[model samples]
Target chain A: MSSLDLRNLKINVGGKPIVKDFSLTVPKGEVHALMGPNGSGKSTLAKALAGHEDYEIVGGEAFLNGQNILEMETDEISRAGLFMAFQYPSEIPGVSIANFIRAALTARLAENEELDAAQYYRRLYEKMDLLKIDRKFTARSVNEGFSGGEKKRCEILQMAMLQPQIAIMDETDSGLDIDALRIVSEGVNTMRGPNLGILLITHYQRLLEYIVPDRVHVMWDGRIVRSGGKNLALELEEKGYDWVKEEVAAV
Target chain B: MPATIEKETSSESIAIDRDIGNFKYKEDYSYDAGTGLSEKTVEYISNVKNEEEWVRDFRLKALKIFESKPTPTHWASKDLENIDYSKIRYYLSKGQQPSRTWDEVPDDVKETFERLGIPEQERKFLAGVEAQFDSEAAYSNMKTKLAEEGVIFVGSTEGLKEHPEIFRKFFGKVIPTGDNKFSALNSAVFSGGSFIYVPPGVHVKQPLQAYFRINAENFGQFERTLIIADEGSEVTYMEGCTAPKFETTTLHSAVVELVAMKGARIQYITVQNWSENVFNLVTKRGMAMEDATIKWIDCNIGSRLTMKYPGVILKGRGARGEVLSIALANDGQHQDTGAKMIHAANDTTSNIIAKSISVGTGRSSYRGLVQMPKHLKNCKNNTECDALLINTNSRTDTYPAINVRGDGNSVQHEASVSKVSAEQIFYMQQRGLSEAQAMSLAVNGFVNDLIREFPMEYSVELKRLIDLQMEGSVG
Candidate 1:
């Protein structure tokens, strides 16, 4: 079984330490949620795990299936079965969404192995139908002039297509309306099964109601100070982050 | 006495004959202007071509104007100063009549054109083929069906000899010889360009193609072309050029005039990839009558210096003109190309879209003019010019002059200059394309809109040419 191990990771951005000594283990067949208040470094942890150039690994290691991911390039890290859905994906003009994703998938294939066009289109159309996206959307430029809901749905579509071993969703529920949120959660739920590990980063417990996680962790000031079952999300949501702050103060 | 002996022995003082053996196509025709321009030379060319006295007088007048007018000193580079008129051969044509079959063409000349893929295009889809070697059209033929339908496709000399009335009517109407010094030179010694006329109410679906090859050194090719599309007629014309590399420079000055009658449509496409030793100065213009349409699709790939501006005059109401131009300049090439539009009647419209790519110290300049008369109402013009520089040493410039006098006229002009960014290359590389492939794709995508306007075969050839230019582009 595949697993991603983050051992005492310390991440820094712009010379300020953000993710400090945070540790989490997501083995295959489990869905984990990291919930925290704003500026608690949840996004930083996700980005650092994804090997974004802006984040520096000052200390500690992140391993994908027992291999260090810190040594690989961003694209290499991606091809090595770790996928991070961006909080804000880049908008590439003049590049169609279908071509972009096809390029990514083509890159993942072995040399001298050509992608079967018929099979690719069949799977693409099926997934697009499931996501309720128009088939004509494949011809439009990548994320150019797309609405917020469209962009989120596009990201989810890519996630579904790539089918990474460890899917890191960084605030996937943000900017989505109620119906869109349900659709996105249902998409995530459909992909949740054996042979896949999920790390969902969110600011509210509302999303946890749909895709309930096996474990919920509370992050405060760049570190996870508490860990509990699914009810921890409900408790934190009911009492607010001030309770966590008061508990830390008591500590 | 000793000095005279030394002068005779030295290479500089002897009066060496400059008639570098005439091209194979010129075997049948007499060399009227052996090597230079004079009143006698103009007279010889006119008489040898059996031109009307009026045409001869026009040539004489143009030769006088050419002799008196000074060269352009203010234009880009002004490298025409080095052209020695006395050392250049003006007119050389094969003495044989235009051939109706490929078998009638001389084998050597036919092989050369075949190597350049001219005959294949004719055999496949072209409605007509005119292959000009040096100063003479070696082969000219049209489909029998087109001939039966009263389509006239022949050389300009033949047109002057056989259809003088129609020839004289529109000879210099669009672009007069006195328009520029090159045009004056072309008029004085012009030979061997295509003459096409479509009968009324007829539409030629397939393209007519002409291939011009310059195989001799220090030779000047001045071909005068005139095309007339009758009412409700449609036609498309494609032309290409290639020449072997030479040490000394060669001069190519051609004049093409087009007339489109009411409800007629004309499309002229040119792909010129001359060797780097040729100076290509061509004048091409078209006049559109009421409800007529004219389009110029020009792609410039190679030349030492090219100064061509295809123009269209909207003289009748509801006339339309369009120009789509693309230029790629490698090392030691300067492509100074653009389009001009003149609105003379009400409700006329024009659009000019041009894209250029420069690499390895090459320079590309866009010079355009759009004018609407004060009395013309509801005329509209949109001009967009973009340049992409592939290297730091390359350069691009845009010079657009717009004069809209009427209050109701609408005009828009936009220009942008951009370079291939390193980040774009890296981004594409991250997606698995090599650096060269990425550059090619980016350059292709940059001109995707204009390239799509070309025919399918031409689009494939253009992509191959762009890919060749992108080779060795990265460090």
Candidate 2:
């Protein structure tokens, strides 16, 4: 009943049309993999859905649980149960991870409610332990001078803390080695449940071997051209995006 | 139909406090030295205080110097031309002796300090406290144990009358009366500042604090502070300043001097939050003897135009000097501040790090001077100045003069100007923070490292004030 539904979404970046006639539905309790090669507009869709000012939604209807999110602002969309894990997370110097997360959490509370420090730290430590992150990482500035793997892990850490209903992770597996990829996939799997829906965007089939999405959608140019089950990933891996390009051309 | 996620067990929200220190109270003063500046005004102040002939002569001579100097329009801001000396009330006081206890203080003055939370701060972490209202000190007190340990902390008026011998020795030695135009103005009608003297080998553990409050409209508060640390002594002194919002312009010109003897250490900290209609021009400097150390930590916020550059003269060999400062200039305000370091002896070292943020149309400038003569050997100096501009209309400037002419002496200067990037704000916005909150967080991060150098309580207060200033900075 609860889902992220996109119908005929049109997007433009800097007055240049990038995504035209895009549609998808990711229901609660399911993981959908949006697979595409370079410049297929996978990342643009994620940024536009999150209300980035640079990505202008020229024509679209994005509904999250029957509430249209295209009319909301960036922070409002976030507060309305949407989260985005960036491809290249920003480096905010001198702002500790603990304080940044705390500020974000504080923004969601009612006006007069005060945060309890003791319980917050206990839960933060629990999440950090679950992700195999060192406890000292909380005191360091957010994403400043972090390794590629560490930055991705920090993104997942925030996703776990914010606990949004629907999440769009763009290129979370890039720039990570094999061990890091396995660890990150484990963290994501640990957070998956009937209450959460994830739209995982990636260019590689290697990532699907770990997370094992229930559905896979292949994008071409600016639209989803093919859709199938988990084994379709194996078919695409065996052939390649070039084969899909030929198939779409024939259609 | 999104599922209800469990709430995080924390709840800390950013609240805006625009007028935390901008409130004021009215008081009927028994002594007012009328408006305008003249020899008669200076003489009237000295005659009322019953100062000796020598002090009165000193004030009269300094008044002449103040009259002779030009408005300094050539180098400083053009805003200096707007200050009308003839319209400002030079002196105001209740004419009551500074009470040693809060109960003995007059009711109105006591309520003013109480509203400012002076007594509460004094009880928590201060060794001594002095509360100055307008032109005179209302209350001055210290712990008995510190008094027994030979620590002298009292108002300047009492210091001049009771301990003339020691007070007169170094009163204007570090910063001379004719050093600058504002210094001359302060020397002519100075009142209500602290006078401290620490004996040899006496280490005052806690900080000695003084609170300067400006409550009168169109009034000038001139406070003179002199601190002398005898050989091998150490002391930390902090002073906070605030003024109420007034339609007319107010003037605050104070002169502070320090003398640190051989192997002595003196640390001075200042947090000034004047209203938008006040001009804060202050002269603060110190002298460091052989193996002595002097450090200044200054934070300037909420002033229309502030010109203060705390300096140190390394007179003896192996002396050290450092200055750490933070300045924030909001709409209709200008924060012009920096540091000066003079290395006169061999093996001397100095460090200066200044960070400023300019919001709206506010302007902030960093003006610095560092000199190491060719005669000095093995001297080192490091200077860093960073500025952050919040809006397109905001402005910042840096002027640094370094003159080091020795073979083995080394100097390093680094200056940077940055704007909070749009990408950074967008990244934070995706996490549910409003644009203003994100800007405040970014501004706080820019100055976070510098603020860690401040004391715990002051740092907390400074952060709250900064948050308040950034409230409407963005749409």
Candidate 3:
């Protein structure tokens, strides 16, 4: 029952429907891959689930661990254990990465409670060592001038520190090379456990080769038209996306 | 002077949005100049203080200059016309000389400084402290060790009375009365600011601080501060000001003069947080001699209109000047501030870095000047001004005039204006921060480089004040 369940979610951008009649359920202890071509409403679904103001959820019920998320504020939804790794992260010029992560974690604390700096740095250093990030990065501004690979790795580092129950990684492999992709996937795999549920949204099948998914769902025209096991990803990679469009049309 | 005009009770106290530095206690003043400015008013103040004959003549002369000069409106904001000189009480005092110990201060005055946490700060880090209420300092104290080392840290009144030789020589020398209209006005009716002088080769280990509090409505607080660092001496001086929120407008005008002798250095820092109904106009300038350095670190927030541009005149060979400033303008506020550096000597150098933030309908302007005359050789100047606008309605402007002549002199100027994009706010919000927190974080980040230049104690307090100003700024 610990899962993210979406029922008939409809989203609009600037009053134009972009996500129509979408439904998915990714239970805990599982990794689900949502793959589609460009402009297939994959990103829309991710943004709408994160409660972005621009992505209006006209009608839907998004429950995270049986609590409705649609009615909550953006930050409230985040504190409710839902993490969204952005495709293009913002550059906060003067905020160091260490401070940013500390603020995020501090937000999760109860009133009259303070964060322990020693323990926090210890865990942060451990995670950084695992991800191959230098210790000096803690002092640098967050994503101010980071390379694409470094930006993706920072996202994973944030995810590791936050320890969210559910995560939605949108195009995590868009601008990464083979080495960067491998490093990012390794960081993600370290957090994969029975307590975490991941919704990996990517267009290419190459990312699935690193962190294999339990299920593959093909989204077309705003809704999922095909669902199968992990091999469905390789099959779709072998057959072009046009084949899925034709198959959906014929059906 | 006319009979002491009773205070008109504010129909309703302006709702203060923040809990910090917004409370005021009832006023029971022993001397009030009764809501006007005239020769009689000036004479009344001089007579009450029993000032020297020369000082009294100086005040009369400055008063004539103040009346002759017109309000500066050629290029400044139109808000200058709103100040009615006849309606403002020129001075108010509790009539007690500045106490050397907090126990001797009146209860209400003591409670005011206690709430502002001034005495706590004095004990923790400051070597000397001065607390000014209205037109006179309620408490002024310096460590015995510093006073034993031939350092003089006292209120201006005592300095002028006891050490006339040094005080009179440099009182209005750095900033002459005719320098500007506000300077002339301040020279006529100034009171309650600090006077510090360090002997040759004596460096005060800790900073000396002054706190100015305006407790009454419809009053003008004109404080004149003068600091002279003797040859090879070093000192750091800091000041802070705040007033309560009221429906009517209040005025605060001050003139600060600094003199850094040969090989000496002086750092002057200020953080003023007047209520939104107060108009703060100040003139601060320093003179650096051969091989000397002068630096000004200023931050302005929580005022209706603030026009302060601290300047330094490099008058000797190899002198240096620097100004690092941060300003935040909230709704219905205008922060017009910048710096000025005049290189009158060979091989002089100056640097200016200013950052401002405009929230809601607030507007911030940076007007700077850097001049190197033809006679100066190998002089260098660098100026940078950056502005951040929070809402679409927020505004910012920059006006930098650089006049560099001669073959070896060089000048560099750069400016930028940016807005907090929706994406940046949303990005921080997704990390579990409220909209207001996110906005404050971004603003703090924008001024992070400059804030680091402040003293450690003040940097923390500055960040907290910024957070309070940003509480209701965002949706």
Leading candidate by lDDT: 3
lDDT of 3 by residue, A1-251 (tens): 76899999999999999888999999987899999999889999998888899999998789999989999988998999999999999999999999899989988999679999999999999999999999999898989999999999999999999998999999999999999999999999989999899999999999999999999999998899899999999999999799899999899
Error of 3 at A162 (Å): 1.1
Candidate achieving the largest TM-score: 3
Q: Against the true structure, candidate 3 has what lDDT? A: 0.92
lDDT of 2 by residue, B24-57 (tens): 5554789999999999899889987899999999
- The digit string of per-residue lDDT tens for model 1 on B311-405 reads 99999899999999999888878899999999989999999999999988899999999999898899999999999998899999998989889
TM-score of candidate 2's chain B against its reference?
0.95
Residue range with the least summed lDDT across 10 consecutive positions in model 2 chain A:
A111-120
Between candidates 2 and 3, the one scoring higher on TM-score is: 3
Backbone clashes in candidate 2 total 1
What fraction of the real A-B contacts shows up in model 2? Answer: 0.81
Which scores higher on DockQ, 1 or 2? 2
Clashing pairs in 1: B26-B93, B26-B94, B28-B95, B29-B94, B29-B95
Give Cα distance to truth, residue B337, candidate 1, Å.
3.2
Candidate 3 structure, TM-score to reference: 0.97
Output the lDDT of residue A220, model 2: 88
DockQ order of candidates, best first?
3, 2, 1
